[model samples]
Target: MSKVVLITGGSSGIGKSIGEFLTYKGYDVYGTSRTPERYTDSKFRLVALDVADTTSIKKAIQTVVEGSGRVDVLINNAGAGITGPIEEIPDVEIKRNFETNLFGPINVIKAVLPQMRLQNSGLIINITSIAGYMGLPYRGIYSASKGALELITEAFRMEIKDFNIRMTNLAPGDFATNIAAGRYHAPVTKGSPYETKYGSVLKNIDEDVDNGNDPALVANAVFKIINTPYPKIHYKVGAFLQKFSVVLKRILPDKTYEKMLMKHYKL
Candidate 1:
């Protein structure tokens, strides 16, 4: 029997690419989206899901397992981006961002764990971001949410490794996706202190995202991780400079790293 793969936010963007690619690779792919009608792909099955909602997450995973009998791989790729100055970002917006980017995956992981543990084999790939490691100026909330997921994934690995279940954090630097258009912008009031700075930083951020690597790169990475017996704990996809930025942040002094990031974002 083919391995069953479940991917959240699979209606579009990186999730869609991954779902389609995996289906072609012979996996029984099930993808989740808030609006199932929005996804017209015939290759993989689409299930209605709202990751931020625990009931929705539970129902979606239950549907997949009922249809497929097993979930060999679970990819938590559903996430939202919130951009703007930290202070300008509303509390509600921050909550919504974290709910999708961090807690959404958490709910899915919880829903799938029982079956995965009972089967004694599974792989969970959490799609994180390089920004998770370094704080971005205007996208601080997005970064924070991803960073939380990264840490949670690491901890989850330790907890579940004994169950023959594997976990990986796929930190994509940037991928060409609909994320920018759908991203939440924290309210920037007129004459606010962060208005001009936020605009400049956001513009630069948008350009970089527009020029990001294809989502197919991420799909290929996912394929490799699934096929490998002992995949690394972390996988990064993007251009050399973008991927290497994580390494730079690790090796450089705090002040130097901040300077480099500021220069890169033109802040």
Candidate 2:
């Protein structure tokens, strides 16, 4: 039987691309969405899932397992984005972002682990962000949430190693997707201290996303990871510079890297 792949937030964007590509590669693919009915044209099967809700996560996993008999891969691709100066961002928004990006993925993993252990074999991929490797201006909350997930995946790997289960973090740079439309933006308040700089940085961020590489690149990476016998703990898929940024942080002094980011963001 073909490998059964389950992807959360797979109704569109990178999740959709992965689902379609894996389907073409002969895998049994199932994608999740908060409103599955909205994606009538999705290439692979889409089940209802709201990562923030524990009950919904359990039901979605059960649905896929019942339909496919097994889930060989689970891609935690569902996440939300938030942008604002850290101080200006509402506490509620910060919690909401974490709920979707960090806590949600954790709960989904918890829901899937029992089944994965029963099968004695599985792969779990968490979709993180290139920005997760560092703190980015106007996007600190997003950075922290994704970065936390990256670390969690590392810890999870060691804990599940004996079960024949594999886990990894795939951090993608800006991809041409509707993520910008979905992201929450703290309003550029009139005459506020951060209005001018925040507005400028926000515009740059959106333009980067608009001109980002095709989502297919990430899908290809995911496919590669699934087929590999011994996958690494972390894989980054993006433009050379974006991937290199992570390396640069490792080698450069803290202040120097901070300066580089400031110059890049015109902060």
Q: Top model by TM-score, which number? A: 2
Local accuracy of candidate 2 as per-residue lDDT tens digits, 1-267: 899999999988899999999999999999999999998999899999999899999999999989989999999999999999888999999999999999999999999999999999999999999999999999999999999999999999999999999999999999999999999999999889999999999999999999999999999999999999999999999999999999999999999999999999999
CA lDDT of 22 in candidate 1? 97
TM-score of each: 0.97, 0.99
Error of 1 at 10 (Å): 0.2
Clash number by candidate, in order? 0, 0
C-alpha RMSD by candidate, in order: 1.1, 0.6
TM-score, predicted candidate 1 vs. hidden true structure: 0.97
Clashing pairs for predicted structure model 2, backbone only: none
Question: Compared with the true structure, what per-residue lDDT tens digits does model 1 show for residues 1-267?
Answer: 999999999988999999999999999999988999875755689999998788998888889889989899999999998898887788999999999999889989999999999899999999999889889898889989999999998899999999999999999987789899999987666899887778888788788889889999999999999999987888888889888988998899999999988887776
* Candidate 1: segments with Cα more than 4 A from true spot: none
Give Cα-based local distance difference scores for all models. Answer: 0.90, 0.96
